[model samples]
Target chain A: MEIKKTSLNKLHQSNNAKFVEFAGYEMPIQYSKGIIEEHKFTRSHSGIFDVSHMGQLFIYGDESLTEELEKIFPLDLKNLKQNCSKYSFLMNEDAGIYDDLIITKIEEGYLIILNAACKDKDFEILSNLLGSKFKMNLDNNRSLIAIQGPKSVEILNSIINGVDQLNFMTGNWFNSDNQKLFVTRSGYTGEDGFEISITNDKAEKFVENLIEKGAKLIGLGARDTLRLEAGLCLYGHELDINKTPVEANLRWAISKSRLSNGGFIGSKKIMNQMQDGASQIRVGIKPEGRLIAREKTKIFNDTDKQIGEITSGTFGPSVNGPIAMGYVDKEFSKVDTKILLEVRGKKHPANVCALPFYKKNYVKGVN
Target chain B: MSEVKFSKEHEWITLEGDVATIGITKHATEMLGDIVFAELPEKGSNVEKDGTAGVVESTKAASDVYTPVSGEVVDTNQAIVDDPSKINEDPEGAAWFFKLKMKDQSEMDSLMNKEEYDKFAKESAS
Candidate 1:
């Protein structure tokens, strides 16, 4: 297959980005300043990310559409106010996650932002489920740009004008540069930020305007460090077909009302897991020193018995230490529980720690 | 102090009498990015030519640091192990990985000089 490039490919080139093939797309892994510098810059200021490879699935329908979606997702769509968004997952009958997504209620129906790798499969699943009763469009004409960090609000609001009023996990449409942009107050970096949906043709100029406003373009390397520090899950790593949302420690995303009724797809398995408790559960890990336990590193108990494996691990720039997230035996998933990580044939001490190693205030509560 | 010699593995070696100091070149550090952790060969250990003598981990990944020539490990730099960022900051100077007592000094004769190494580095990178 031909490697795909985003509309901002030229802009990334101008910034001296080092490209890497990600999910079949030629994407920047880091710029010339490198991952550490780009990470620090984002934490101290603003950083823009090009997420155009993700699918922007707009399903147009009315009240019936909301009712039908409730049968598939665990969210209470009827009670959800317009413009409000919820973090959710698409799952199989056994409750194994297919993808983690953000779905927002719009005037027409709903807008779902899906992971790049799983978008096609998710669209197919949804199409088969809905059976063509609702109009679905996995629009490729739009680009998703996320501006994150402390200074993101001020920088993005300067151009969009009304984005500051949007609360976390909410979105609204606004006219900017004679084009309609769907602006949302959400981001993966756990900072007060916004994700702007705009036309592909306007992406380059729009990003240039952000660079002019002091927001530098960060690449996938820093993006990984930032999100890991924030304790957010990446699709293929932290959640996959073999992992359930309950086992992944994301049961909070499931609606309480739906849990009791158990009508959603995979609801039976989800309810059973919620009651029986998953044998293995996800938790944050802090290595004793500077040793990085990369993905697939074996996790062990004090007795040398293998308990689990690391899913995502890295040196968190803001935390100034190594942080990781992985599934461990449910008995060993408590905070401060001692565990051993096997790196390069040597066992090292580690402890289960609370996530979001770095904390910052988010603009929420409006929804 | 002697003229620094380059190895195909990206290590630079400088001989002073029977003791030779070794460190990764600046180009290596540039390629590796911000190094966060380091492990060194133990003192009094004997290593074979081109054998793994240490490990350095950047933010992105972990890579082995190989010894360019066989020797008995006389000393290992604890400074780089204590703070690996120095390897990226001053890799060729303050970040020398180890010092070895030469097992066979002829191993240095096969190494590249500064000019030959510059060409090799360029061609290999391209």
Candidate 2:
């Protein structure tokens, strides 16, 4: 099958980006500046990304739409004010996660943003759950772009007005050159930025305008390292159908009202797990040697007993050392606990560290 | 004076008198992307041809460097060890990984010349 190319494919190619196939899309993995430079650029300056492959959906119905959504997700949608967004998940009957997503309560309805690779599966699962109670419109034609870095707001302010008023996790509809679009103050880079949802017809022009305004286009290579350093979870790596939010350290997404009301899908099992604690918990690892502990590396205790496996690992550009996140037995998931990572048949000493291995500079005053 | 030779794994060795200077080729450095770190063999250590001599790591992947010719490592480039990006910037010159005292002169003939190595790199990319 032919891989789908993003609208900015040519732009990336012109900039000499190394393209790679990711989630059925031909995307840029790095550029001429290389991954380290790009990763540092995002932290120090501004980095733009073409994330149009991510899924965007609109769920509309009567006043009961939020009530119906509450039945499937564990978030407290009743208190979700308009234009505010919440990170949530779709759970199976057994309380296992189907997919993790961000749901924004829009003016007229709900806007759900999902992982690119899990889009179809998520839609099918949500459709089967809702079943005639709500109308679901898939906006696959719309493209998504992220402008991330410390200078993102300053760069965006030069073009769009009133964007400074948007706090974290909030969104607003805006018009640019007679084109309608939605902008959200959210990003995966752990930096303060915005994710712009634009029509396919206007994506090219919108990206060009942003680039012309001094935004450096980053690729998947840097995006992975940036998020990894931030201790943010990638969908397939940190979360999957077999894991729940409680195990993935995503308890913040589970609202207090949902814990009390207990009306949502998998609430009994999820809440029970929350109360009793999960068997395995995600923890960060800082490897002693320069050799990186890549994905699938085994984590062992001092006694050489297998404890966990690395889900994501890399030579973090920001951290300047090998860093990883993995699921360890609950008993060993304490801060500063020493562990060992078996990399290439040799054991390297590691220490359990705090999350967000690199502190995020999301809003200077807020964070 | 002897001509430079390259291995299929992209390592290059140049023989001058009884000493051979070794490092990765430009093609290899470009494919590895931004190199973050390198593990080098200690000076005065013996290595065998076609054996693992050291390691080179990029942000995306890590690979072992094989000794193209058997010798005793006499000296190592401390500059590349300090900043691995030198391999990406000048793989052929300043990025030379190590200097070795050749144990067998016949081992030099086993590697390919510039023309053959260039062709091999192009075909392998395809």
Best by lDDT: 1
lDDT of 1 at B87: 90
Runs in model 2 with CA error above 4 Å? A364-367, B42-46
Models 1 onward score TM values of 0.99, 0.95
lDDT of 2 by residue, B3-108 (tens): 8899998999888999999999999988999887787899989999999888898999889999999899999998887788789999999999988899898988
Pairs with backbone N, CA or C atoms under 3 Å apart (clashes), candidate 2: none
Enumerate the candidates' DockQ scores in order: 0.91, 0.75
Report per-prediction Cα RMSD to one decimal.
1.0, 2.0
Q: Write the per-residue lDDT of candidate 1 for residues A1-367, one digit (tens) a residue.
A: 9999999999999999989998888999999999999998988999999999999999999999999999999999999999999999999999999999999999999999999999999999999999989999999999999999889989998999988889999999999999999999999887889999999999999999999999999999999999999999999899999999999999999999899888888999999999999999989999998899999999999999999999999999889999999999999999999999999889999999998787965897643
Q: Kindly list the per-residue Cα lDDT of model 2 for residues A169-272, writing each as its tens digit.
A: 99889877887779998998889999999888788877888889888999999999999999999988988888888898888889987897688888887888
lDDT of 1 at A31: 94
